[model samples]
Target: MTLLDVTGLTVTGRHLIVDGVDLAVSAGETVGLVGESGSGKSLTARAVAGLLPKGLTATGSVTLSGLELLGARERVLRSVRGARVALLMQDPFAMLNPLCTAGVHIAESLPRSPRPPSPFPPTDPGASPFGTVPADPGASPALPQGSGAAPTRWTRATRRAEVLRRLAEVGIDDPSVADRYPFQLSGGMRQRVALAAALARDPELLIADEPTTALDATTQHEILMLLRNVQRARGMGVLLITHDLRVAFELCDRVAVMYAGRLVESGPGFDMAKVPAHPYTAGLLAALPSATVTLSRLEGIPGGVPAAGDVTGTCAFAARCGQADSECTQERPPLREIAPDRHTACLYEVRPRPRAEPRAVTPREASADETLLRIEGLRKRYGGHVALGGVSLRVGRGESVGVVGESGSGKTTLARCVLGLVTPDEGRIELAGLDLTRRARGGGQAHRLVQCVFQDPTTSLNPSLTVGSTLAEAAAQGTPEGRLSVAELLDLVGLPASYAARRPRALSGGQRQRVAIARALAVRPALLICDEPVASLDVSVQAHVLELLRTIGRELGTSLLFITHDLAVVRQITDRTVVLFRGDVVEEGETARILDAPAHDYTRRLLASVPPTP
Candidate 1:
């Protein structure tokens, strides 16, 4: 049965942001809505759940289990939310209350009086209705003649037990976690708590919006497996919204591609991966960096997605599409069935391109005498927790070295120590034979020797400043010969010189990251440290950023310390790889050697955790 049926869904605010989109999810099915940022995937999911932001009006048919929900009353929608449907956002922190403990959050989601059906059914007939063994296995037997008092419909003891049960179901085995606040938990732990809360109400339809975007590969795989298991056990329908095609293919039964507010393609995950029918879908797949295959360059989509109201009578993607012509620009193609159980909105049929042979990357060996940055016996401690323990690495001039590790594995901590943001408990950092450790302690001139590019450009770049102003500020601090005009800086990063006048808010995610790179380049630092620089970007944009970093190293002769959890990205950009596990360097060798034949068990586990290339 169709659990969620959306037909002709149109969402309008100042303009038609989400145009006519039709999607469906069946019971026990997982449907993936895949798209880049600002592609209307989230808005469509919100509209289906009647949770659109103010000023955005949704007009269409939204049926949840045969009940219309688009124009439903607020009371009706309120009743439907949590009880019949649940939404899991990208950031669990945003959904969880800081003041509430984990137990409180889950308990609040539970219905009072008559309880809903348990999310999991009992395997044994004699088990409790809540899908657990009896709370007291050794309790005395009931009285033979009329018990003194029958149990109430719902009790405090039962509610507490249910909350703990839910937490355990989501893989939180420790009961003490229920009393901890959101801030006390790790990123993975907090996400599990949020999942427990979402299932507390026994929702039939769950909409997970990028739930594992910020997690490490292992944690992401764990969450995906947990979600799949819960969905299968309860027969719940899932609408997973994500930009990662690999992730979508890993767990989704059906995959739907959305582009510029429209459903461009829909098909089975296997078929879509093997042969994409739409040009845009193929473009996204081609842009992805591979964990197993090596490419000289990623074919990133040339241009950004068109803003709403930019495309009127033509296809929204035609401007960036390589296959587009005058006909594509003149006519908008409606989504139609192109093959059995497959649909596409392209005018011409697109078949799978021939697989390119993996290119052999020649590793750049840095001689010992030419090293630009070197660390010896690096260590950091926060109370009893050790962040980095005797970790040592070196980066040669113009060489790109990658640090791959999960969260809390000393990647960011190491970067911070190099950036002088943290004073290491013990270590020696040398830049160009200068004692960076002493410089950091003495407030010396290390800023001119090194610079950084953070993960989220939105937070790194000041929102109030225009692109030109931010670049100018960084330029002023650099050597006189290194300073360049704002326009020159913009051009160097492949952005139009005209973009100098725009602010960070005015640019797309890719554009803002370009501006960030331009600012970093303005300093003309000898060493560049990037911490998860492209983690949040879509595939094409991420490819563009990675390529830009490579170009900067090649053309400008700047050494790079690239820190990220994505092994595919490391394979594409780094010459050498260092694998960190729990504050220790478990492996370090040539990028190709480590990726092809990992020596350490932790390194092998990290490689195994990555979703297979679709």
Candidate 2:
């Protein structure tokens, strides 16, 4: 039975965003909507629930369990929202109330008793097609049994017990977690609490949008597994939205590809992974870094997703597709059945091309004489916590080294110490044989020798300053002989020289990151520290940025101290790997050796947490 049916769904604000999209989710099935940012995946899901933003309007049919939802009254929509459907957003912390306890959040969604009857009738006597609340246990022992009045099913005791039960269902076994506030929980714990709240109402359909995007590898894997288990146990339908093809293939039974606000392809997940029928699908898979293999370059799709209403009478992906020709630009191709249980929107046949064979490239070796930055017995302490404990590392001229660890593992602390953002309690940091530790404390000239690219470009790059102004400011502190002009720096990062006039807000996430890289290079530092720079970017955009960094290292002889939790990226771009666990260096070796046969238990656990390559 179809749980959700959306046909001819069109969302419009000032212009069309989602155009004529058709989607469906059947009972007990998991469907994935995979696409890049601004591809309308979230908007489509929102449209299905009549939850479009203030200015936007949705038209056409959106039915849930045979009831039309589009243009429905607010009261009608409210009645079905939590009882029939639930939405899980990307940021659990933002979704949760800081003032509310975990138990309070879940209890709010439970059905209240002694209330007016529902306007909508139940589908059946014992159950409802949407969702049926479980039979409540009898009233607490304190209630009088001899009273003539009926015992209330939704008593305070029952609600508290239900909250605990919901939390346990999502893998939160500890009962004390219910009393904790959102800030007291870790990222994984917060997400689990959010999931428990979503399931509190016993909705038949769940829409999860990028739920694990911000989590670490192990936490992400755990959340995915938990979602799968809960879905199976309840036999509920799911519509999961994400940019990761690997995740989609791992958890979804059927996958749909969306681009430029339209559905480009739909098919079985495993079949699409093995033999993609659409160019966009193939490009996404090609852009993913392999957890087990290293490649010189990832084939990232060129150009970005077209803005809504930008493409007319032509294929939306023609500008970026390698195989597009004049015919592809002449008319928009309609999605049509291409094979058994497969559909594609491409005008031409998509043949399965063999992937590039893995080639072994020798890892770069750093000689003692060529060492650019050296740290000896670095230690940092904050109150009762130790951020870094005697962590020592070296970066040679033109060498790229990866620091891999989960959150709270001292990776960022180490980077901050080197960048002079945080003064270490004890250590000797040397750059070009100069005493960096003293320079950092005294505000000396060590800034000229090193630069950094942070994880979030939006926060790092000043929104008020244009790209040109930001670059020019950095160039002022650089060596006069090697300083790059604004236009030159923009060109080096593959952005147009004209982009120098634009501010960070006007550019896309990828474009803003490119500008950030350009600003970092404007100073022409000998060593660069990147702390999870591509963690929030789309896979294709991440590939482009990683390749750009590699090019800079090879051509400019700039040393790179890359820090991230993603081991796959480390394997693709770094020469050596350092594994940090709880402020301690657990392992250090060649990238290939560490990834292939990790010596430390923590390193092995990190590798095991990575999603399998599709």
Candidate 3:
């Protein structure tokens, strides 16, 4: 029996992180952990790996074949940790040893000892007590086709071969990817390496925490598929913990909704996504740009997470759940099966649930005559290949425009050209009627008319500067003191005057992002070119940021060229949208018209990939 049983798992700490939770995973099963930020998804993963941060304490039984996690010695768990159950953490750049070759990391995760089990338990893939397997194969070995991963095809040469295979599976076209170091590879390549290293061990269960949050759209899709492939081929149990349901919908078979360190509901991923039994889960799904009922319409569970003391009695979510009543605050809901395959944690009735958010809205159309910024015959060939092939497009003044495509599709090349960061080898960028190329050698308003918001907020913000100072840096070519004094700019982004004191490390992902936006606006550029702005944020947070960007464009006379692969986001905020396929503008039109009635086949396929809204 190779099932993992986590019963009455109450993980707590000096800070009261996760309280009560129960979960199980059998060989070939994949359990998704979904939640908002600060919900303790990562914390739970760390506890399982015996790598919990300081000040944390766990009191529960996490057993695999009768071995207790909390009761076992660290050394004993260490032996089985990587060899039996592995961890695929978020941010591979920091997880992978920077100095070592990617190959070495894969090799190092291999089993330390090959000795057979001294006293193996009555071995059976079926008839597991944790409900991972059935007693009879004739009765169906397990769930359906995606019930769980099938048995693995692993061998001695599996590490190297699997590494290459997983890389290819994750969409690494170049075979040399296996030989590159973590630093030498692009973000997507590095992520593939991390996946390879995690799967190289051929463990029974794999824990992945927000694996695709850092990747671009095409890369994110590729990575998601790679995980599914690994699960299918190995039939290994997978615990995918993440804040994004869109991710879970793509690969997970089932999902667990967590909040303030508690598992409130769990069931089939598609079912939960389609008909969330819990209000918190429903709100999460509602906040997705794709799930918003209509443009500029959204519903987020109000109030940030309550502190430990503020959530003592009854349901932790009652404070934020709109359906909460006195009974909700007075009694804690139990995890009970509400239907054939669904479980929810709510005492109050969730009568016939509302319709899920729509997957893709009709995109609005872009005006052909109202071209605010136009790129004509853009060409930036790096020695041999063309990065952008005479790319041309237009953005209406004070309008939001979305540009999406695969990696190296000239998305960044085009964005950089617009920002004047990358000088095009050939082309003319006409912004506000002034040609960018004509003024390359002299100071002019055209040069200062556009700004960029990068993908990685960490690298984009200075480590030493406070959020206030970071935002202040955007002032147009003036000394720190001469610019929009830190205070004014901080307030511009809805940040408090006090935020001027907190450094980047002291802030959250959403806050840091606001700081980045604040910095860009400091220059008072006529055009704001944002590149994958909300890719790393949670759904609720993404809704807020995208709305904020759209709001800023409307309130301030700032025209925006918003770039992202999330079609849902484009549908919500953009007045006009452009679909880029392999460095080519395949579709361009009004947001509502294009989003609702996508004409291009690639755009339609992209729309179809999004999860159905409830």
Candidate 4:
């Protein structure tokens, strides 16, 4: 039986965004919706849940267990919102109330029912031996035989027990966790709490959007396992919306690919991974970072995803497709089954992988004897907690080093200490053989020696300044000929000259990240520090960014200090890898050797936790 179904669904705002979409999820099954950012994956999910933002209208038939929900009244929605259907949003912090306790949130979603009577009667402590009368007559309460009226309301004790049980179901066993706020919990624990709340109502269907995107590799694997177990136990339908093809194949039973608000392909997860039916899907698979060997080059789909409601006539992905023809532009192809259980929307034959020329060996193997960055005995303490405990590392000229660990693993603290953003308690930081750790704070040579690109470009870039001005300020050495020009920097990062006039808000997340990189390069620093630079980007965009960074390191001959929690990313970019655990370096060696034959137990666990490539 279909647990949730959508037919002829279209969402429109300033223009037609999602058009004529059809999909279904049956009981005891898992379906994954995969697409790049702005490809209408989340928008389709919002339409199904009847939670579209203002100005967006959904027109479609959304049926849950044969009940129509499109134009249902608020009262009708109230009956199905939590009890029959539940949604777990992408951002747990955004979905949670910072002011409320975890227990309160879980308790509120529990099903309401009349309380059962206590098993034992209220008796005096002194007269409980043989059913004798109590000395104090008021101590006992009279009760009728057999079946008396049940209590009309639930008590506080009953609610607390139920909340703790729900928390335990998601593996959050700490009793005090129920009393803590969202800010007090880690990202994984917060996600677990969100899952507990979703399970509290015992819904038949669960919609999880980017459930593990913000988590580390180990946390991500654990969450996937949890979801798999929960789905199997309850036989509930799940629609996992995500951008990770590896995750889609790992956790979902069936997978569907979407582009520009349309379903382009659908099939069994394992089969689709081995043999994709659409060019877009094939491109995504090729872009995944391989663990077998270090990838010198990663193929990326050309051009960006089209704007919502801007696609007109023919195939939406034809503009960037290598096999596109005049016939493809003239007619729109209908989705049809190519195999027993696989369906594709394209007219061309599906290829397992794109043909590529032999990858030329990148010349980043040799490092100069000159050291660009040196750190010794780096230590930082925040009150009683040690952020970085006697850590030491070095980066040579034209070499890239990777610092990888989970959250709260001192990766960011090390980056800050290098950039002079945070003062270290005891350490020696040297750039070009000059110690700058104990120097006074100012925009001196220290800032010019090292520049940083943070994880989030949206918050890092100044919204008030134009792209041109931002670069100009960084390259403040007079005329365009004497110093690096804004236009030149923009072109280097793959952006056009005209983008100089646009502000940060006018650009997409990928474009903004490129601009941030360009800004960091305007000064031509000796070493660049990138802190989870591509962690938030889509797979395709991340490939492009990584390629660009590699190009910068090769052409500019600048050293790089990369910090991230993803081992795949580290393998692709870094020459040496340092594994950190709770502010201490557990293992450090050549990137490939450390990953393949880890010496430390923590390093082995880290590699084991990575999502397997299909």
Candidate 5:
């Protein structure tokens, strides 16, 4: 039986968006909706769920289990939403209620059942209602108790039992974790909690939107495996909406490639690698680092996705496609059946281009004795948890070093320590032969010696300020001798001088990241510390950013401390690799050696987590 059937689905407000989209998901099937940002993948999902943003109207058929859902009333849709279909949003943190405990999040979604009273009801006035006494004098109570509290519909004991069961299903084995808040858990754990909450609804069809975007490589692998297991056990249909092709290729049974709000091509997941039928699909595959045998310039599709109402009669992707001709631009191509299970919308059948042979990056010759930055015996503790324990590394002048680790592996903490944002419990940091052990906390010359580029450029770049103002301010703060002009800084990052007048909102994600890089370079610091800088960017954009970092290290002779969970990216960009497992340096060596033949088991696991090309 068809779990979901969306035909001629169009979302329109003042402009025509998500035009003529057709998709389906059958029982026990996982269908992937893959595309670049602003490609209407999420919009299609929202159209089916009746969750389109304000002013946007969804037209055509969106039926689930033989029932039409597109034009259903809010009350009618509400009944089907949690019971028949559940949505797992992109950001787990945004989905969670900061005020609620982990248990309540799952418990509230469960079906009605006869429940028992609290197992350990509070008898003492000063004790926690959940049966724990406060250890600190001024500690806030875990569960606040009151004299005449209004009764809830569900029993505490039953809710707690259901919560524990749901948590276990998502791999959180500890029942004690029920009392913890979302903020207390790591990124992976929080995502698991969100999954548990979604599973609580016991829906036949589930929609997961960019579920692993914020997670580490290992954690992402775990989550994908968990999703597969969940689907197998429950025989549930999944409609996965994401930009990450690897995640979709790994989990989904069928893949649909969307561009400019239209389904361009679709086929069985495995066939996507061996036989892609659209130029856009082939381009997306080639853009992946895994697709190449060696580091080469990623042939990113030129030009951005056209805005709604931007393109008229022509094929939406013709503007960016290299094979486009006058016919392609004059007539829109219908989604035509190419094979028994494959379909594509194009003027010509495209195939995956042959990758170039492996070519190793020649090691740059630099002075081995010239150390730009050095760390000795670094130790950092957060109360009882040791974030970093006895870590040591060094970056020579003009060298790029990669710090590889999963979440909670002390990568961010180490970056903070080096940047003087956090004082390490014990460590000696030497920059340019100057020991910044004690004076780092004061934010003097030590702070100016190193500059950082953060992960989310949306958060890092000032939304209110124009690109020109942001770079100009950074340049103003630089040393008089080293200061750069706004135009020069933009040129250094390969951004046009015209972008100076525009704000971050006007730029694409890749452009925003470039502006961030430009701002970082304005100060002309000796050392650059990038913390997951390309984590949120598209694969093509990520390739460009990595190239920019490499160019900076070579042309500018600046030392780079690149921190990321992406081992493939590390291999391409950095000369040396430092593997961190639970705050300890498990392995340190040349990038190629560590990746190709890892000495530590943890390092091997991290590398293995990287999804294979196919």
Candidate 6:
């Protein structure tokens, strides 16, 4: 019997969204809802949770445990929410209260959780060394020392013990993490705490909505493993909603492809990954940029999703699909089974492209003596708190150097020092023999020697200016007479000249990234510093941008100081890698060698924490 069932789900507000979609989740299975932004993946989940915003009318039979959710009253759904089903929302910081400790938030989630027979029972035969213990009975356990909390109430203390255990299970080894507020921890660690809190109630249905989107690559892998363990132990059905097809294939038992508020396909993980039947699904799989895939065949859908309010076509994806024909444009396809347990919503059967062959990036053409960036004993002190402890590194011309580290590991600080944005207390940085520490502040030669592409184009670009105008501003030099047109810059970045007239807000995340790259190349900086450039884009788009960066690096012979948390991306982009931890450089070597055989203890932990690649 279906644990949760929905048929002909139609959700509409002031716009056209979530049209006639059907889905079901068994008692103990994971179903992935994969799509890009505004595809109605999230709106469908919200309808199930009875958490839709006001004025939204949902017309469907959302029967969970024989109770309809579409029109359910708030009071009724409240009991079902934490007690029966829990939601792990997209933004961890928004999900957590800033003023509360990790312990405080986790405690609030367990409204009436099942007791573990004993508050401090003996470890389960299957329990790992760092599993959640039963809550203490009779008396609450004491909080960890130096948590900045006075001897507290028994209930609060008991909750703290359970919270600490949960955090540890989610790969946060620092016991004192329970004491830190949400603001103190890194994005990945905070999300781990949020997951711990969500599972505190142990609901039968877990709705994980892009829970790992904001984390570093290593943390993302760890969280995936933790969830796998949790799913096996709890036997809970999960509805994992995300834009990452890779994550869906790796974690979900079954996958559902959504496009413009409709189910385009559904099938087993391996089947969908290996051979997708729908045109949209096939396009999505083909766009992934893996080490194995060549650039000739990897291109994304040309247009964005149909407007939420104007989705009145035969097929929502017809506008962007390469194979779309008259029939595809005239009538929407129904979700019909093409094979056992594999459904397709396409007029014509579409074949999925072959998986890319993963090849190690072998860009070893740069000679060692042709140094592009050189750092010596870089140190930064923030009122006695040292951030970088005698750090030093070098990058040869035409090289991509990867920087890997936990949050606050001096990664961004080092990037800032290299960019000359921050004055280091000690040591010196030079780009092509030009002292960045003593650059021309009056808009001189030093400014043209290096450029930086920061994270989040939304904030980095001037919102008021068009993409064309912003690119022009970056190219501004001493004499106003020597200026390059914005169209030339856009063309250089593989964008249409028409895009030069468009505002930064009008571009997609991937497009915005390309624009940023163009702006950085304006003065032709010898070395480029990229801080998580692709962190904001979808997986398929991420592949394209990485390839773009690699192409630019090769074609221009521009050395890069690329700071990212994604080891997968590192493997395909970086020639050499350096691992940092707690303000100290842990290990530095070739990307393949370091990942395969890390020498330092911290580096080993990082390597171990990465989830086993599927």
The best candidate in terms of TM-score: 1
RMSD of each: 3.9, 5.1, 7.4, 7.8, 7.8, 5.0
Best by lDDT: 1
In model 2, state the lDDT of residue 206: 95
Q: What TM-score fits each model?
A: 0.94, 0.92, 0.81, 0.91, 0.91, 0.86
| Model 2 TM-score, all chains together | 0.92
Q: Which lDDT tens digits does candidate 5 get at residues 1-614?
A: 78899999988988888888899999889999998898888888888888899999999899999999988889989988877899998789999998888898887777664223222221231321122222221111212234423234556654565577667667776888888998999888889899888877678899999999988998999888777767765678999988888888888999999988788899998988678889888877766775224465544566678864676577888888878889997877999998888999987877456553466765543464787888999999999999999999989888888999999999999998888778899989888877777653445466567899999999999899999999999898788898899999999988889999999999999889989988888888889999999888877677678778878888998889999998877877788889999999999988887887888989888877888865
Q: Which digits, one per residue and each the tens of the lDDT, describe model 6 over residues 334-356?
A: 78888999998787778555545
In angstroms, what RMSD does candidate 5 have relative to the true structure? 7.8
Candidate 2 residue-wise lDDT, 1-614, digit = tens: 99999998889899889878899999889999999998999999998877899999998899999999998999999999888899999999888999999999998877664222222222231332213222221222322334434346767775666677667667676889999999989888899899989877778899999999988887888888778766766778999999988889999999999999899999999999988889989888888988788886776788899876888578999998888899998888999998887999998887554455676968777789899989989999989889999999998899999999887789999998888878899988888887778543434357777889998999999999998999999888887898889889999999999998999999989899988888888888889999999988989899899989989999999999999988889998899989999899999989999999999899998998898888
Give per-residue lDDT, candidate 6, residue 308: 48
TM-score of 3: 0.81
List candidate 1 stretches off by more than 4 Å. 114-154, 351-357, 439-444
Better of 1 and 3 by lDDT: 1
lDDT of 4 at 499: 98
State the lDDT of candidate 1 residue by residue for 65-160, as single tens digits.
899999999999999999999999999999999999999999898776434344354323132122332322112121112333423455667666
Error of 3 at 571 (Å): 1.5
Model 2 ranges off by over 4 Å: 113-156, 353-357, 438-444
Q: What is the overall TM-score of model 1 with all chains considered together? A: 0.94
lDDT of 4 by residue, 1-614 (tens): 88899998899899888878888999889999999988888888887777889999989899999989888887988888888788998779997899998998898887785333323223342322223223322121221224655335557765676677667667776779999999989888899899989977778899999999988888888778778766765678999999999899988989999998888899999999988889999988888876556775877788888864666577888898878788887866788899887999899896567533323333244444577788899999999989999999888889899999888889999998888778999989888877878757435666767889899999999999999999898888333453788899999999999999999999988899999999898878889999999988898889889989989988998799999989988888888888989898999878888887999998888888888887
Candidate 1 overall Cα lDDT vs. reference?
Answer: 0.86
lDDT of 6: 0.77
